[model samples]
Target chain A: MTTVMVVDDHPMWREAVERDLAARGFEVVATAGDAGSAVRRALAVRPDVVVMDLQLGTGSGVDATRDVVAALPGTRVLVLSASAEQADVLEAVKAGASGYLVKSAGADELADAVTRTAAGDAVFSAGLAGLLLGEYRRLQAGPDPGAPQLTERETEVLKLVSRGLSAKAIAERLVLSHRTVENHVQNTLRKLQLHNRVELTRYAIEHGLTDPDSA
Target chain B: MAGELRQRDLLAPLWRVVVAFRLVAWVLAVAGWFRERDDYPGTAAPVAVLVAMAVWTAVVTVAYSRAAGRRTRVTLLDLGVTVLVLAATVATQPAGAFGEGAPIVTSIWVAGPALAMALARGRDGGVAGAVVVWAAVTFLRGYVGDREVFNLTLLVLTAGLLGYAATITRRAELALREAAAAQAAAQERERLGRAVHDGVLQVLAAVRRRGVDPELTRLAAEQEVALRGLLTTGPEVAVGTADLGTALRLLATPDVDVAGPAEPVELPAHTAAELTAAVREALANTAEHAAGAHAWVSLEPADDEVVVVVRDDGPGIPDGRLPAAAGEGHHGVRSSICGRLADLGGSAVLHTAPGQGTEWELTIPRGTPR
Candidate 1:
């Protein structure tokens, strides 16, 4: 059974998320009102996924997301916030949140986002996905002219990522094992010091790893 | 007020008329004396007085035209010169030659000092100076006749009327100065109103529109009222300096952490208010945008400046986000945060990027010279 932890400053919001996850057949391991306690509870429970609010009273949700990801890389964070700001979405993404959903999202959508995050898929609200994609393209245009050269296989993975292909899909297309593809992705991430696929895709586009015809 | 006499536009024509009259008196006195040359046996004394009067009138005409020449000392000396010339005419004239129809050396030239004193010191100075000259004439004549008494009263009345006119001119000048001051103050209030409109009022309106929490809406309404009062009240006219620490303390709340020196950070009231307003706008941005954020504010006073830092632990503003926000009509960071500091001759530096939190350093110099 999938396990989830809810973190929100508002009692009602935390309770609602907890109830929704429970009704969806997911076990809610714990709930917290702030970043510190959320991190502590997340570590103790080792929930498969954490549904976190961006604002957590006196603590920061972004910081909590970072802590949880660092402490338990196996655990995923799905941020739910009242703001649909581009900066907020990007920050949460850079902090290692697997998904971001606004509070205005329906219960079903929240449940679906949580399931996708647990299944290791990056989830985003409707328009936010495109916004992040556009931001990635814009950021890619301006960077080191002398970018680190990528291996032939890393470039192939980069092209697939830029075309918005999933890692598993890229592995199947390339006739490689999923673990080998992930290792290539990790190697590129280390060379670039980028935190996520979003940045990597942007870097690929800037360095002309992706073809316009393929995209 | 030192150059009040010369500054009187109303008196400029009067001064010209007085000068013209003195010139006419000199011409007339000379003509009258020459026509009645045989009437006075001694020519030396009257001729000497006549020459002195001509020289003095010529000197005064040029001197009074300049501001430095219009000093109180010069006015009094002019009066003394006229009085002595009048008295000398009496001593030089043969007995009974200064009777009715006879010409005095000063003639009507005494009007110069009478009108000048009125312009300088208003009614009282005019009346006093006229009386002094009138007494010298009466003393030399050696008898208080009907004509002498009539002339003395005439001098006093003319001086009084001229003095009254001077008082009116002075009052008009004062009123003009006060009107100019009021206009400047109104302009300042208008500028302050615009700043408030861009900053606090916009935040409050946004909060009110969100309508998520009733308590937040109520707080916004309360602030709206307070902000309106602040805009209309103009800058406070309190005597003592404003304490920056005390003003900063007012911003500290349960969610915000404020740290500053125990000693009062004494600053001019307007500067303190500007600095505080900038800080308030920064806090408002954090509350409205940064989710689950905690804020910290610190103040450090350097040798000649005060450094205030406001930081938040939240999803930091992304690179290029501010410019993008500006394009999308976000004025909080532009007008409220930076504009206010710029007006006070201070600077606001924003430090932020994606993933990292945001911090702002506001540095304002001491003793703003508004």
Candidate 2:
């Protein structure tokens, strides 16, 4: 089971998240009330996923995420907030959060989110994910000498993946064998020289080749 | 200080009257001395009379120059000239002329100086000036004539009393105007504050939270910025004078048909802001609960007041539902429409029953200026 942690100032909201994560079969290792305590708990537990609220009682969630991410590189942060405020979204991402979720989301979506986040699959609300990907795409489009470019097949694969297609489905649609589809994906990874699938996904996103919602 | 003196713009006519009156008074007084020179027999007496008239003319011109001039320096100059004119006239007419040893006309010139300071510098300046003149002239009156001391003292008392009274009346009028201005400012602030609270601020705060529409959020931000801009532009926001009908139509145009007189219904800034805010709140409620049905508006302008009515054809508001709506923080109707208009010396009428449509009427006295 993936280890999880939750941090929030409100007791009710904190308990609700703990209950949701527990029901999803993830082991909730700890909870915290403030940014300092969140960082300390995150370091101590080294949970695979840390679900944190943006607004804390005594400190900022962004700062807490930065500290936790620095000390425990294995841990991913999922930001939960009542606000979809643009400043909060941008600031949380800058401070190293992997995902941003608004609390208006239902319980099942939150549970699914924590599960997906622990597996290293990025998650965001529908519109907000587009905003983040758009920003990354804009930054990548800026003049850069060392930026990598994808071949026609790799670009097509990335677009399919962004459209929420699996490899089996992609093979059927591209009229290639499943094995051939896998080889193209592998070649794409090796040529792009990325270590993992997550980096490939991020690259697809940052180049505007894929819509995050498709994932 | 400059704000108080903007009334100098209004005093231009009074300045003209003072100058024209002074010129005529001086010319006639000068002509009288020349025509009656034979009556004096002694050229010295006639020359003294002319010199006295010339000094009076100079002092009156100085008073005119300062129509809104400095109080202290002008008063002192007037006193010096009056003393010189009176003393020179006494030396020439030592026995008597017009049964007077001195022109005592010098005292009459004192009125012109007092009036000049009063109208130009206002009451306090005039009062302070009139008191000094009265004191010095009372001393001069005691010695102005050898035998007419008692009579001259009485004249000094009457002259001082009259000038002082004019000073007090001017002060009272100024105080009334100041009070009116402060009231207008306070009422305008209350109107704008209610507008932001009802329409813009609450939307922004909600958008900051979840469960809010992004389109509404952007609109709220735009409106907040618009309201702030209006404040910096000052209270002269008279794009049009709004009677009850026009005001309602302005609030609900295109989507709502507003009916009323086309005649200009002049409203002070405060009244217009409050009415517009009330209309906005009512329409926002319609949009939220009325399911996008068209609203109808009407204005009724009375001699001293205006009434604005905005009605919507939709799911009618339920009976005895205002209290529940207020409890649910649907404050657009309660605070924005009803309570807001009331603060501006107006009343709001909410007409509805279940499935009968909702009609809102706001009555504001035209004279309230709020």
Candidate 3:
């Protein structure tokens, strides 16, 4: 069974999600109500997937996601948040979340997302795809020469995804294999994450928060 | 309540400054009377006027401190006292002493009323008060000499400039109050939005996900989408323009998914409305003809054009179905979608097969008609 951890500030929501995931055959290994305990609990249990809520009442879920992903290399984070927080969702993704699912998703959809996340597939919503497309376009328009660029095929696949096409449908339309389509989607996210990491390191070095020799 | 009091007293500091100025000017007048006491024919009238000037200055000082006390009647009374003091200079001075350039009994203290008038009204009132004083000075001197001309010019300039400054300060205060009110309103809205998101929206989403009753689920889903749209909308756009992304997001329902960039996609307000209307028509058609079909609307903003794609995963239109519908006087697709895009100097292309889904690609060029 895929081990899962749920983090939400609302006790009702946390319990409901825990029950639903347990009913769906996933092991409910750990749960937390805020960012601090979330990281601590995730480190203790080392679950296969962490379902994160963006608003934690005390601290940021993005920080928890970064800490959890950094500590456990085998674990993946899937943000289960409200759809309205686009900027926070994007930040969580850059902080190393593998996928996003709105809280309104049914139990079946939630299970499918968790399963795919555990299998290392990029579970994207159309909104996330749109945000990534916009981010890439923004970077292209920026002054940095070393900014990441998407291949033409990746852009095409991302556009289809933004239009609410499933991976299987995108694979059939682009004449690519299903795993290849998933890889393209995953690669886009990986590049964004890599760029974010580089930017953060550069910022740290410039601000003298990190020693250049050690960095 | 504190902000209301502060706003009401925006000019309180200005009035205090004016009072300080009057006290300083009154001291100068007293000094002038003392210095020229030997030059006057009789000291009693000048001494009486000096005492009256002292009493009036204290009265106006106390009166102007409060907002309710700074009235037009007080300002007019102030001007009347200033004129009487200036006229008294004639009785105190020796015969032909004005021709020798002896200073007036009130000296610089005459400027007090002019400044008060300026603060109460504006440039016009300041000029009017200065002119009244200038006329009294001219009558006392019996001629417009170089000294009288110089005094008139100085008084008018001081009153006019101070009046202009007062007007600017009032305008800036009003603008600041407006901006602060707007920011406070926005912050309150954000707080309410957070509360709604934390409590109400969560319950609604849970209800929708439970799917206990189809109608209840549908209502909950619609409210969730509507509330999310309201909370996530960008700041108000400039007049004559609208964020197309926000308009598109409002169309999102359980069966129809709308996606757009995080940044605002602004277009001319008319263009955005027409494009939204066209998309609504397309979604309505999908609901009527393609039962149980899920629709997707995506907004793509490019360099020189905006593209909207509405696709449905229902059974596609067969060959010649569009033309056949047009022939049968059903102009839904012809007039509503395609014709609307055509009028916008854009094009709508439909792609479909018998078993495949239907897709409508609508493109509108930027900076067209408007």
Candidate 4:
């Protein structure tokens, strides 16, 4: 069973989410209410996935996400927050969160997002995908003459990656070997110093590598 | 406070003009003396009397130019000196010198202190300053001539006219101060209205929507009580900048977590308060409508604007719920949340759907928009 830890300030909301995930066959390992303890507990538990909220008492979920991601390479964070603001989504994505889900998401959607996030898929709420894409377009419009260039194949894989396509999916669509797709993804992550596909997607999108026609 | 300073500023130039007029009068007296030198009875030294008038003019000008407030003794001394010089000229000159209508010593210089006194003490000071000068003229000639009486009338009129101007200036300053205070109060009231409309009213509306669900009603009641307390206490008289991060923290509880930048996201106090209030409204909605909702608040400071996001982990608003709510006269989403931002030259965007949680993106630019 996949192990998950929840970090949110509210006890009732935390318990509800824990119950929902537990019923769905995921093992709930631990929970934290504040940012400081969320980091400490997350490090100790090393859960496969962390269901995190952006707001904590005097602490930040984004900071905690960064700390958790830094400490555990295998761990993925799925931000379960109330805010759908583009800046919040961007910050969490930058901090290495694998997915962003608003609190209003159904238990099923949230559970699905958590499982997908653990499996290394980037998930976003309904309209937030468009908002993030718009932000990426704006960022890509800026001048960055010194930015490192990617090869044609790597750029193709990145464009697919930014469209929220999984490595296996990108491999299938491009008729490339799964191993070859994974290699391109790893190389892209290294070049951008990004930890996960989510960050890679953000970078690709920011560099205008994503194709609107393909999406 | 500024109004008082401004009133003094306006009066200061008038004082300068009065001093200049006094100086002009001294020059005219000196010229009249030189042109009529041979007409002197020879009883008084013309040069000595001319020298005294010139020295007094110099002293009066210097005293008036100093930026001192309420120089009562100096003003009194000025009036005293004028009377004494006029009496001395009459005592020294032969009776024949008075046959020509010109009063020899310090002639028109008598009205100088009257203008100063009128500015300093209003009409009363004007009348008193003119009284001493008129008395000297009356004492100099045993019987006052028609021309001398007319000069006395002119002295009193100058005093009265200046005194009235002083009164108007003071009244205008008071009106300006009152208007400023009223504006501040009105601005604060509107901010308080926005806060109430955003937070408390939304909670109450949520309770109304839930309609007799005991648990939801109980939660709504608690919020209603809190809102009532806030309304009764009223908003603080906000001034200067407020830390957006710090103000946001107050909206957090066990269920609600507020995260912000380490650095202060400072905004104008009213804007910060309004923004925080809008965030609180978002939280209140989550608590009231979103079942078992966990909400988060995050602040991001950009180059030109501060972005505040209030998110909740509850079943989100239905697709048409906001418009429906507005149609039903539920203004929490409209006026308190969006209208407040509009007033500040900012924008509020809401993202939510059934089974998805509601989030508010509040963006306020630095400084007030024109």
Candidate 5:
């Protein structure tokens, strides 16, 4: 049986989780409450998986997981907490936690997370995957060129297009001639290698240059 | 207690009004005394009138001070003193002193206080207090001096009318407060609903609807659910960043009950973000290790420090033996929760036992906002 460790402070909650895990065919190796003890237990038991609460009375699970994963080497940690803050999800991944799951998850998901963690598969919440991926892409992309090589006028024209403003409206707002605004739009499309306003909107949104509310 | 204190603050200005009334009355009475001496030189009636005015001024002052029974027993003492002064003045001056004017003046004093007290207690006792004071004033004014009982009665009736007006003001105040509180509460509910609608609930519904990802759709759905849970709720939530409690509650799921205070507690946005990430890592550990075991997560105030605690009844950790726990991992507790807290000048505490369970507490002081 795969050995798993549980860390939490509430007795009833701990029991319910343990029972669920046991039923799911995982052997419970150990449990811990605080960060120090959690580290010690995770190291000692060398459980295949560790389910940790992001919040602990005396310690935090993220720190505990770091220690556990560090010492045990192979132990995978699946973080469980009531919050779904994006930073926490991203941080847990940073801390060597294999998965980040909110407490509102069902018993099945909890059990599944342990299995997935043990399988060495990356686990994250839905919808937020885009955010994580986007962040990852940003990091990979490094500091973008000081300027996207687009002129200030180009940026303004793109913003207007994303906002659904007609060339006439953009011209009026910017106090430029209508033909001048259209020229700027054509220039922006060429610079960004975009064909139409739709593609222009997507690019602006991806770069966070456009408001989602506007889109 | 805070509500009561706030109410007291609201009533404080009323006392100032009372003080102003008394001061002016005293001044007028002294002025009237001087006028009588100038107009009716050597006349006993003028002297009587001046004395009466002086005594009435003192009585009204006493009545105002004595009205705040919700405050202390000294008010009763003041009342007794006022009544004595009124009695002395009535015996020497006009018979109308105790006959009718007394009750009306008492009513005036009671009206302000009754309304104030009612706001704190949320009961009709405030109105009752006003009525009792009004009646007492009327009775005292009616039976006192010989200034024609009918005229005294009319004075008492006029005071009652004023008292009624005061009561209306109080009622208006109460209605306004209630309306404001209700508006706030409704706005809060709407905000939370929106968060769910836009974030958590929507994610859940979407996951259910769009579970047909060509690759890892289920995981995508699950991730969306997590993201949704992370979003803040409540109307105030929209105007600014989420409070610690709201963030915790939104992140709450099957593993634990995460809750924080309702009032918005601001933390350094960057620090908050770091700590939030730490919490997420810890929560993931609970889900994987605990295997659906119950858990609790809490954020509390601890003597100039904010403490986050997560607990569960699971097997305990043996003493020492942390050598392997500190290994390098792209995803590990050290980098996830501890490192994040450490970055914020906060430390995490973990306690465990074989049969007992595990409790983790993270204490972050207010000042250390890196």
Candidate 6:
């Protein structure tokens, strides 16, 4: 069984999601209501998948996602949030979240997302694909020479994904194997997360937050 | 009344400086009177005048400190007392004093009323008060000599500059207050939005997910989209342009899904309107012909143009159906969707086949001809 953890501020939502995952045959290892407790519980439980909500009572799911991903490399995060919280969703993805789904998704869709996330596959919703396309465009507009760029094939795959096409459909259209299409989608997110990490390190070093001896 | 109090508070610092000037000038006047005491035929009247000036200075200082006391009537009374003190100079000085160019009994203390008027009313009031003082001095001396000319010029310039400074300070204060008010309103709106998202929107989502009744689910979903749009977008853009992404997002319903970039896709106002109208027509066509069909509208922005793809998973159009419809004078798709794009210096392509579904790709270039 795939071990799962749920983090949300609403008690009702936490229970509903827990019930849904339980019915779907996933082990509900733990749950948390805020960022601090979410991080601590995830560290203790070491679940294979963490379903995160963007809005916490007094803390952010993005910070929790960063801490959990840093502490356990084997775990993956899937954001379950409202469509209006697009900016926060993007930040969570950069903080090492693997997938995003709207809160109104049916139980079957949620189960499928969690299963795929546990299997180490990138789950690209049409909205996340759109955000990634816009992010790459914005970065290319900047003056940085070492900024990340997407291959032509990756851009083509992302455009299809943004148009609400499934991975199987994209594979059939592009004349590639299903695994290759999934890899392309995963590469786009990996590049974004890598770039964010490099930028943060550069910022810390420039501001003298990093000691010279450590460097 | 509140506005009057705020105005007084804004000008309080300038008024303080004016009162300090009056006290320093009064001290100098008293010193001059002591030095010329023996020159006067009788010292009794000079002593009385000096005492009156001292008492009046204290009275006006206390009055100007309060908002109710800083009125036009009080300012006029202050000028009247100043003129009276200037007139006393002629009575207290000897005849030889005028010919010998000795200083007047009021000395520089006469400028106090002009300074007060400048801070109270601004440049015009300052100039008017200075002219009244000049007239009194000229009448008392019976001449406008070099000394009188010099004193009048100094009084007018100083009063005018102080008045200008006070006016600038008051305007700055009003601007700062307006800016702070706008910031506070924005923060309040954001707080309310967060509260609504935490409670109302969450419940709505949960209701839609329950799917107990199709009609209830539709209504709840529609309200959720509307509320989310209201919280996210700002006031509508200006007349010349609009965000196409925002316009298209409004078309989203339970069965219709809209996807676009997080950033705004801006286009000319009329262009965006026509494109939105075209998309609406396309969705309407789907609803009419393909019952139970789910539609997706995706916006893709490129460096040179924007492409909107509207696709529906439904029974596809039969071969040659479009040509036969055009022959039968059915012009819904041709005129509504394709014609709109044609006018925008773009093209619309429709692809369909048996069981393959229908898709319309509409492209509008950024540099379209007016």
Best by TM-score: 3
Interface Cα RMSD of candidate 5:
16.1
* Per-prediction DockQ: 0.01, 0.01, 0.40, 0.04, 0.04, 0.35
Q: What residue runs in model 2 are displaced by over 4 Å at the alpha carbon?
A: A133-215, B1-370
Interface RMSD of each: 17.9, 17.8, 1.9, 12.4, 16.1, 2.1
Pairs with backbone N, CA or C atoms under 3 Å apart (clashes), candidate 6:
none
Docking band of candidate 4? incorrect
* Model 1 Cα lDDT, one tens digit per residue, B202-263: 56645544547978866764565456434532222323467665576466543454545334
lDDT of 2 by residue, A1-215 (tens): 99989998766557767776787688999999899999887888899999988767589987898788768879988887643233455556656677766554455778888887787655634223323333333334657534445556755654444323456867987998987766654453333223223455688899998999995
Residue by residue across B1-370, what tens digits does model 6's lDDT show?
5885466477888888888988998999889878876666777777788888999899999988877787767888999998987787677777756656655777788888888888778887788888888888777777788988998999999988888887788787776775676578778868988898788987887776666898998788778877776666433454468888888878876567777776778889899999999999999988988988878888899889999998888897899998788789989988999999999999999988878778899998887423
Residue B193 of model 4, lDDT score: 57
Candidate 3 per-residue lDDT, tens place, A1-48, comes to 999999999877787788889988999999999999999989999999
Cα-based lDDT at residue B230, candidate 1:
47
Q: Regarding lDDT, does 2 or 5 come out ahead?
A: 2
After TM-score superposition, the amount by which residue B178's alpha carbon in candidate 1 deviates from its true location, in angstroms, is 1.7
Quote the positional error of residue A17 for candidate 4 in Å.
1.6
Q: TM-scores, in order shown?
A: 0.36, 0.32, 0.69, 0.36, 0.33, 0.66
lDDT tens readout by residue for model 4, B179-294: 78768877786688567645555556445334368677556544543443333322233346676755764564435655443235567778888888888887777778876777
lDDT of 3: 0.86
| Model number with the top DockQ | 3
Q: Rate the local accuracy (lDDT) of all candidates.
A: 0.70, 0.60, 0.86, 0.69, 0.55, 0.85
Q: What lDDT score goes with residue B296 in model 5?
A: 59
TM-score of 4: 0.36
Error of 1 at A150 (Å): 87
> Candidate 3's error at B214, in angstroms?
4.2
